[model samples]
Target: MSSSLPSEKALVPFVSVENMMRLVHHIGIETMLAELADFIEADFLRWERFDKTPRVASHSREGVIELMPTSDGEIYSFKYVNGHPKNMAQGLQTVTALGLLAEVSTGYPVLLTEMTLLTALRTAATSAMVARRLAPKGARTMAMIGNGAQAEFQALAMKAVCGIDHVRLFDIDPLATAKAARNLAGKGLTVTSCTSSQAATEGAQIITTCTADKQLATILTDNMIGAGVHINAIGGDCPGKTELHRDILKRADTFVEYPPQTRIEGEIQQMDPDYPVTEFWQVLTGQAEGRRDNSQITLFDSVGFAIEDFSALRYVRSKLDATGLYQELDIIADPDDPRDLFGMLQRAK
Candidate 1:
């Protein structure tokens, strides 16, 4: 190794926000979303190999902070994130995160990256991956309620992974809807801004709710959702927050990433403890069914999960060599002599 290069054990690859954006632009956002879906699906297929748990959260009146951790024997990963809905009004993001990937054997970090953007990508990819299997066949239109930071990513992911050709957008804030519309203008999707949630759902085969408010708000009611459509309710991710009504859950065949977590945080929080839900990994592994019929309604009650973030970090690690978008972070202390820590410090002095 060159003297100029930091010790391998001390150097961890770091992808900063600028690098993440550059990588997204380098790979193209839609293409990256498609690729990420592939990675997420592959991990889901081998779901039993991982250690899964609900995120450990610290909740306050304003927002919640969480630590999501998981491992697949060979590698371990975790993410530190916060959800503060009122931050948007204060000129801050509603969600921000950082993630780490490490070797399970040595417990040494291999990569660290800003996941605020990556989270948006992974969440969109996760939704689209599930929609690919559960949405009505040949689905071409999507209704995107809550056009906030996550709106454009969800639209493009659906377009890339599920072949959606049109997206009808609605939001409580008109500016947010316009922002999403403007961002998605030339992305080969027909963008329509609707006056109401009902208008957005008209003639749409897939409905995605990604609102940011931290409350028990019903973005989609049972009457608005008809047969033969898929609902991707991603906004209701915490204990008190939900985007769909209880009747909708009762009417649809719900799927989830992890039930224990989703029951506490997802749309099904309103349902009984025994509310039947098929884990999506089971669907990918062919152990369960996805869409039963043309008229069947499939609801993916997504609350996000650690395995998905682990896959995202793994995907980023795989791309670091090809993209060279990461910098080596000297975060670990390496002593030349294994048993002479004090001697190594004195030698340095």
Candidate 2:
């Protein structure tokens, strides 16, 4: 029992899937979504202060595994994630993730958590945040084109952040639409299950397409979309996987998280290399415009970004103390003598 024992530096907070779910329930999902949106927006405002890069991806015929990393001088964070559309048919999740946060100076990890849930929250928050700015004013109804695991989160985020009260749902699989409709039954939303994509978009001011296919597919055609609506296309997150018709990209003004990354992974990948696109951060900083007129078509080609995951990790870290939902793991080795690694190990024997 020496007072010289290692301090709390040896322990790192870890949030597991169960703890993350409890934390969400504790904060209330809608409230958490709104707060996460604020955190993401604050980070976007300081976009230039961060080190940003496109996620490094390894693509296979069935799926893609990616590493998304970013740093803000003080803290460093990265998320290990994968997208396997085939997993769903195998009774598995289409996406799964884990994230880590560390100190920039010491290169020591401070937080390790299951990001499968956090990613859903942050992705939905990002979409709702952008919709609040780019969606037509007084927009209350949304068309959710692909009702998968992300459907409820996206719908509630829109309700919580963008004041959406109704969501029209459709999926190639009727079961997904039924699942979404059943889950959203009494969640303060008017949920409608539609048979086709075209039926879902009727009277909806916001259209969100989130299909999970590893190849190019048209979930929304040009004629299916109308003027004065915002399109949040979140499914096309890797090369050769897109959800919109090329003509739609030609007709609408597209905004993205990072141009270089979006051009490689987003719907804009179908466009010319020099095709013009605006980064959403510019809209937040008033350096660029959003939704010029009521008749304008605004498209948020959301391919997800490292900075958004960074913001999510930071947000979860901020809640650890108050919620006490995280566990501390002894992950770092602190020897009596910093340089005597072998000597410290011998003492334990």
Candidate 3:
């Protein structure tokens, strides 16, 4: 009777950054971005379908670590990411991450993949997704305020998603700007390095603030922003971190991913608790409006959300399954007999 039970084994897939990049290259960045946008929009329309929660954040004197988890009744996903701005001074990336995908039905993991690269990809993807709905038509120029690891991804996503062909770049570190410009060369866009934030914002249709500072640094002042400009605020995602001046938020018709979480992490945190801001999902679903007038300023206060990670994980899983680019692992255990869980451990010894 015991022998008739199932084998004490389970299969899961493990993927690496190299494999993930191969998958991305095969599928083409434009196609992947389009599909991810579709998934995000679909998920947004069915907002009630997900079990949402704010991320668990662990703060340190040097930086902050976060775990973002979410489920949709069947699939569960979570990302382990850390943000250490000062680490770059020591030659480490400002942000590093990894994530897991699981089957909720049996609590089994499906994939474990490094997210350092994926995080950059998804953050850029999400920024572009929001910009599509909020930015004014015929927008071509973008001001990228931060020239760190995320700068290239943001620039690529904008080009693929928003038809942006020129990027005006600025960073506190000239070398960082040079690195971004070097990465973006021959990507069909003109990259200009600027010395000041005000210089970068001039004549730009969209402004993206992805600075990697843990302090309350204001990258964009109120007077620097112009009408019909769409601001993608990405860096100010935790308590004590912000990029935009409070007055810029006061004039713009601000949009955020999730209000409850954004109030705590987005640039809106500087404003009152009752500050009126529209959820970008609402704009996607047509439940609310975006960019009422051509001259109106639009702000997307992006604090990398769990749903974006969910969409990213879903896309990666689908690609891996279709291409067989992942390796299977024994991440879960099954006992040959019911109530023999302890015996299985003994058998291994």
The TM-score leader among the candidates is 2
Per-candidate TM-scores read 0.97, 0.98, 0.95
CA error at residue 285 for candidate 2, angstroms: 0.3
Q: How big is the positional error of residue 233 in model 3, measured in Å on the Cα after superposition?
A: 0.4
- Candidate 1 regions off by >4 Å? 1-6
Tens digits of lDDT, candidate 2, 52-113? 98898998888989999999999999999999999988999999999999999999999999
| Candidate rank order under lDDT | 2, 1, 3
Q: Could you tell me the lDDT of residue 29 within candidate 3?
A: 72
Query: What TM-score does candidate 3 get on C-alpha atoms?
Result: 0.95
Off by over 4 Å in 2: 1-7
Candidate 3: residue pairs that collide: none
Q: Could you tell me how far off, in angstroms, the CA of residue 15 lies in candidate 1 after the best superposition? A: 0.3
lDDT of each: 0.94, 0.95, 0.87
Positional deviation of residue 329's Cα in model 3 after best superposition, in angstroms:
2.2
Taking the tens digit of each residue's C-alpha lDDT, what string does model 3 give over 266-329? 8988999999999888887788998887799999999988988888888888887589878776
Task: Please give the range of 10 consecutive residues that has the lowest summed lDDT in model 2.
Answer: 1-10
Cα deviation of 86, candidate 3, in Å: 1.3
